[model samples]
Target: MTVENEIELTAISGRRSTFEGDPRPGDTLPSMKDSPAVEAGSTMTMTPGLEASRDQLQLQENEEHSIEVLPPVDGGRQAWLFLLGATYMEMLIWGLPFSIGILHVYWTNTLFEGEGASAITLAATLQTGLLYMSCAFFGPMFAALPRWTKTLQVAGLVIGSASVIASAFVTKPWHLIVTIGIFYPMSCACYFPCATLLFEWWHASRGFASGMMYAGTGAGGTIFPFLMQGLLQRFGYKAAMVSLGVGYVVTGLVALIPIKRRIPLSRYDQDGISRIRPRIDWAFSKRKALYLGIMVIGMTSLGNFVPSLWLPSYVDDLGLNKPNGVALVAILNAATALGNGLLGWLSDRMSLRSTILISCVGSAAACAFLWGFGKNSGVLVTFAIIFGLLGPSFSAVWSKIIHLVSKDDPAVTALTFSIFAFVRGVGNMSSGPISESLLKYDTMRGVIGAYGYKNYGILLIYTSITILTGGAAGLFFNKIRDV
Candidate 1:
């Protein structure tokens, strides 16, 4: 039969039903294949060639549920309120590190007598390394924690807060490292899963929500420096640490009460089989997840912690005192938060790639132009502002990943995110050391050039270049279509 004739035949054949009740004279037949037929209360006529059309409609519905594209999900008021809690908690969590530059200087000047800039640099790097690396371990763990996510989040907040507060009373490098790096991140890891789950609930608004939550880091970065400086001036480092830590603990506890996973469902085929596999399917390994991993690793490795870890130190090197240095850090973080919101909004409306590209390029230019030849306080402040605003705007990266990937395939989503975390973790691990080395290079006055290039400034130039390359990666990413 011709295709059209076959379609007609199929439609007619599909309508041949065995009804539970007697059919009325005018009652249209139903398809046995499409579940059992009802009585004369309602009737569905089988139109010619509609077999194909019905199949197409069913498939479209299934795809819509699976793909998470088009109009987005049906999140209600509760979901948005949850997002707000997340935004505040995350801001508190992320902001602490952004303000660490001030702490680093404070530690070097007071707590660690004779501890040079390099030692301080290493400490900040380790803090960053722990924070980023924890995400990789926590991402998958968070995904698997069907229960206990909240428990862990609460525990993390408590520990992080207590640790920070307690650390103020200690006077050793290992003490700070153990408290800030290991303990603090361990607590933060509790929220990672909750954050990703938020995306599942708010798929349509995921980019915007993600940006808001991530922007908390920038906001924290912006506010905490000034706060810390003020507290330090008023009550000394120990008192300030206790106050900040207590605030984090209290904020986290309050915020976490409402942060919860939404409705749950089975991942099963209609044939009554679960999608969960007995073992890892090695076959799926050679796919898009791997490429995404490489991209994340390279991009993150380039300049992940420059703003959070190095910017304040660099500012201090430019002849600024403590408060002024802290102010510079605040500017960068505030700017970053602004960038996150602006760029995130644009990503949903425009091409995500284009937004990220612009962000990366802007960061690069700020680093090279503003920081490279920055002579006076004006130039330094300007560089910090521009860099703070534009540098970490790359927060769009995760949002773009979610947009490109299919949410229905949780395995793929989980794997891709795992890889992203892994790469970014590695980058976070190295960024501190790399940045320190660059600073060291810049400090070796009259070695690289006769003009005595400012090592910190030159390193900032390198960071800018690395960030610019990430932009290139985003642009090139457009070519690979089938993820």
Candidate 2:
């Protein structure tokens, strides 16, 4: 073969050349001894087939990892259904607790052998206090136990069931206090936080969802009282307790079965980190403190629940008797449920602060004008219906607090809830005592005095002041963006 032909053949064959010494001047070709590879930058190129194969592998890995870490989104249908189940469970749990009043009266009569209203009210007060106090640990515990959400829910069902069942067997106040007050709260604490996770799954409907959640408390109040009253009248406290406990356990289990973690376990720690540590926001920044202070005043003064517990007794004093009084309690709860639901929806549509202000003012007016000076049964009934309809408007207060802090700030939200709960707890603790003190005294003229108020008329005046204060504070709460 010719030299040029041989050189062309070598180039086409992709053979390397090497040389023992450096190339001579003007020599472009590399010797056989010197050559082992192609020119610079050539090594970086890949065949099109290999490039496509690598891309396919990367895409498969991405899809696999995504499926492993995240939950499948299904146009939010399954999520909404799960929310429904959660809502039902929340209603049942909260309702059962709120309905303890009738049981309180019956238990006092049957076991304590006491007819004093003050003694019976202590059970409710203690139950509320314990529930609120449990808030302190619930946030932290929930943050740490994201992996075991459903487990905590089941435990809540067990605790709630056992509390009432055990209370039925108690013969003393302490027994009632320990089981109903302490154990029930501890269990609820476990479940309430988990139940709130539904919020993460549904943002657009959160306000409506929250309203429905609270309305369950009202529904519980409505149902429990009537049920307990009837049961006590017929089968008595022990049988009633057994039946209620069984019902709670069954309902709780059913509701809990549908309660699931909307987010996959792998997605919980968002920053590619494993093992989430509990973080508490202790800063109590000026904004948080201002919001918290307003809540405290709202909880203690206007937003307090003194009248809700005592209104039935007041009806009795006004000659409404037991049946009508119980019915009135149902009416109040119905109103509360309706009001809370409506106002919550409105708050989301309009302004949360406005809803709060309007609710507080309406409640105050109802107390002062309708309830305070009602002349007869017709007037009193009118007051009861009106009050029930408007009184629960303030239920939007919680949504307001949540809005006042950003959704991403879980630590702050948890702390805010704790503070809110603690303050509200103090109000609940004092409500019975304060309302009782005012209504307990009877003057020669048949005027009743309570909480240093000389008459029921005066007691209404004081509550009006509180309600007004709450309204004013609520008005001052501007809508904090991005909170």
Cα lDDT tens digits, model 2, 111-215, are 677544554556566776767667666765665666565676677778878888898888667677678877877656544653355444445555666676677
Task: Report the alpha-carbon TM-score of model 2 versus the true structure.
Answer: 0.77
Give the range where candidate 2 is weakest over 10 consecutive residues by summed lDDT.
12-21
Please report how far candidate 2 places residue 58 from its true position, in Å: 4.4
Q: Give the TM-score of candidate 1.
A: 0.74
The TM-scores of all predictions, comma-separated, are: 0.74, 0.77
Error of 2 at 289 (Å): 7.2
**lDDT on C-alpha atoms for all candidate structures:** 0.62, 0.59
RMSD versus native structure for model 2: 15.6
List candidate 1 stretches off by more than 4 Å.
1-75, 115-123, 265-285, 307-310, 320-323, 403-415, 440-452
Residues 1-483, candidate 1: write the lDDT tens digits.
112121111111221221111234554332332221122233334455435456654643453222211112435566676777888887778767767767877888877867555655655666656676677666566556545567778777888788788788776666776677667777656456555666555655566777777788788877877888789899998889988988887878888876874433223245775442212334445655356536744674567466556655555565666436667767777887887777777766766567767777777787767666665678777777677666676664575665355332343454456566566767777676677686666454663321145666556656776776676666655666523
